[model samples]
Target: MSNLTTLLALADSRLPTGGHVHSGGIEEAVTSGLVVDLASLRAFLVRRIRTTGLVCASLAVAVHRGALSASAGESGDLETDARTPSPAARQASRAQGRGLVRLGRRIWSDEDWDALGPTPHLAVAAGVVGRAGRLADQHTALSVVYTTMTGSATAAQRLLALDPGDVAALTFDLSALCEQTAAEAAKDVTDLSDPLLDVLAQRHVERDRPLFAS
Candidate 1:
């Protein structure tokens, strides 16, 4: 397949990675009343892109930079896991990683998924898939950032019944920011953390009536 085709497939929400079920923490944020409208949702997304979004993009770039060996790949996964302080966040990452790897194996039959070991982080899975599919590091990073934004945006619309056009506009405003963040992430894999997001994930997991698995 061509690079564009591969990227489109990977970015498709229909890829069945269980990404749709999780709101990227938006559900928890809504439950906590942190995001009740377009303005708050935009703020949440911007913070997310700068923190975990950038971190995930960096890890994906690291993988594309030739950390393909078993040990090196595991190191990359560990690095991402360390930045995620919440147990719920780790579980969600691993779940998405497993889903992506499962789909990736079917697409790129030659690559060895076993080397990534059990419960690879989502960033590691994206990197492996991106490398195998010949996607550029920029595209990989942007896709991660894009999904990070869209997942929560979609969730907010559902949870708050916000205007779809307004939600879309909010995401549109972040295009340049996402590009800039992706470029910076490609340059260095910083250990950035969002404590509030971690706390939200922990709370989400402990809820008796959780809306999302994250």
Candidate 2:
């Protein structure tokens, strides 16, 4: 919790970088009738929080952990990130990721900031700050989980006709999964592979979407 204030503030929906425009497939999923109720949303979000959050946490630690490097963990994390099945999902990630890093540089302390041009991906931004904040595996994991969950929930406010209270409740539920995924990522990874996510992401490039630009 070393940089809790920064983490919470930047992650807040109010900060706004077009995050509301995307739903992480919740819009498409619900529109496609794949998700409709809180129960379904919960299930969808759980799988999402677990897989996506774990990837974010794993990559954050991997890219920055140095001596405690997690190359194997990164391979697994990248596997899922690359496995996103829908074009919208992949574009949504890259689009929001760009916004995350772009905004991060404008507001975050530049002293430690990398002049690496753009963030390239959201995980990079999360990892950079996660390392600075002294967040362990669990905390780091939850941050990314909540980030994606909240972003999707925010979009869901309109996408699913969900109430504000329900959104908050769903976010709370997602918190646990983030922690769980983080714990898994914290452990040594025996093997790493993820193709489904990548395939979906590649397809996302072909789809025509208004919200997220892949």
lDDT per residue, candidate 2, 14-35, as tens digits?
7666666655556555555667
Residue 79, candidate 1: alpha-carbon lDDT: 86
Write down the lDDT of every candidate, Cα atoms only: 0.83, 0.57
| Root-mean-square deviation of Cα positions for candidate 1 versus the true structure, in angstroms | 1.7
The TM-scores of all predictions, comma-separated, are 0.94, 0.73
Deviation (Å) of 172 in candidate 1: 1.6
**Model 2 poorest ten-residue lDDT run:** 67-76
Residue 191 of model 1 has an lDDT of 82
Which predicted model would earn the best TM-score? 1
Models, CA RMSD each = 1.7, 4.5
Write down the lDDT that model 2 would get. Answer: 0.57
**Model 1: how far residue 83 lies from native, Å:** 1.0
